[model samples]
Target chain A: AQTVTQSQPEMSVQEAETVTLSCTYDTSESDYYLFWYKQPPSRQMILVIRQEAYKQQNATENRFSVNFQKAAKSFSLKISDSQLGDAAMYFCAYRRGGGGSNYKLTFGKGTLLTVNP
Target chain B: DTAVSQTPKYLVTQMGNDKSIKCEQNLGHDTMYWYKQDSKKFLKIMFSYNNKELIINETVPNRFSPKSPDKAHLNLHINSLELGDSAVYFCASSQGDRVRGTQYFGPGTRLLVL
Candidate 1:
């Protein structure tokens, strides 16, 4: 079974600054996918960024990026130019890349981020 | 338009009661899923349906049942609910393919069992 761990339960960042959220996972599969999802107070889960385990280069989307280290089994999310809207609970999820159980997602406990003005 | 939607945004019921939550997707995707977020914020998959067929069924209790009348809809029915079952249920959809497809989630339905 694959397990995702988010060590930090709470994090805070000043407005217009950068913040990094750490995540680590244990998986025996060589092919897999890592994702970061954001949930605001409104309770909507939104995808922030995704990284493929095979890709050496990190994934970047707008102000959100991921530092994917396959060897270390670490995938961290970085938010640049953080704004008040970035304040939310972030979840790190892992999914199998192939086979029958690919539809399932394993999620972490989550990290609550507070963006201060 | 909302890609995915779940009915009854909030549900409150007494113990041993029966209830159902409906989920529908307008994204035209072939796969739909049900996930439960516990009080401690741990999210886990309960069931998955692909093209109206049961694909993945986790180690959930028999009191919880999932029905998929069509590819675009998946409904969860709970019988004899317990306080331990109180959690947020999320509905999601994605394209059924060999590779990992991005999933679109619906605003969760908060269930409270008193």
Candidate 2:
């Protein structure tokens, strides 16, 4: 079974600063996907960004980017120019690339992110 | 328009009671899933259906039942609920069970079993 680990339980950053949430996974399969989901106090799960294991180029979405190191089995999320709305519980999730049971998403325990003004 | 939606945003019921939460997706996706977020903020997959067919059934208790009347709708029915079942349930959908397909999540239903 694949497992995702978010070492940081809580992270805080000042407004307009940058912060990175650490995440690592143990997966034997070379083909897989990693994702970052944000859950605000509203309890809504919003997709921050995603990275395909085969793609060496990191994924970027506006102020959100991911440093995906397949060899090290590490995928960390970087939030730049952080805003108050960015405060939320961030989760790192993993899924198999294909084949049976690939539909499942294994999520980490989540890291609470606080943005201070 | 909301891509995915779940009804009864908040549910409070006594133990041993039965409750049902409905989930619908307007994204025209072929796959839908049910995930449980426990008190510790840990998320896990409970069930998944693709094209109205049960695909993935995690090691969830038998008291929990999932019904998919069609591809666009999946409803969860919990019988004899227990306090341990109190948590947030999220419904999500993707274009297919493919690797790159991004799953879009719903607002989530917060269930509290007293």
CA-lDDT, candidates in order: 0.93, 0.93
DockQ of 2: 0.70
At residue A19, candidate 1 shows an lDDT of 99
Per-residue lDDT over B6-110 for candidate 1, one digit per residue giving the tens place of the 0 to 100 score = 999999999999999999999899999999999888889999999888888898999999999999999999999999999999999988774647788999999
Candidate 2 structure lDDT: 0.93
Every prediction's TM-score for the first chain?
0.97, 0.97
Evaluated against the true chain A, what TM-score does chain A of model 2 have? 0.97
True-vs-predicted CA distance for residue B95, candidate 1, Å: 0.9
Fraction of native contacts in model 1?
Answer: 0.72
DockQ of each: 0.71, 0.70
Q: Clashing pairs in model 2?
A: none
Off by over 4 Å in 2: none
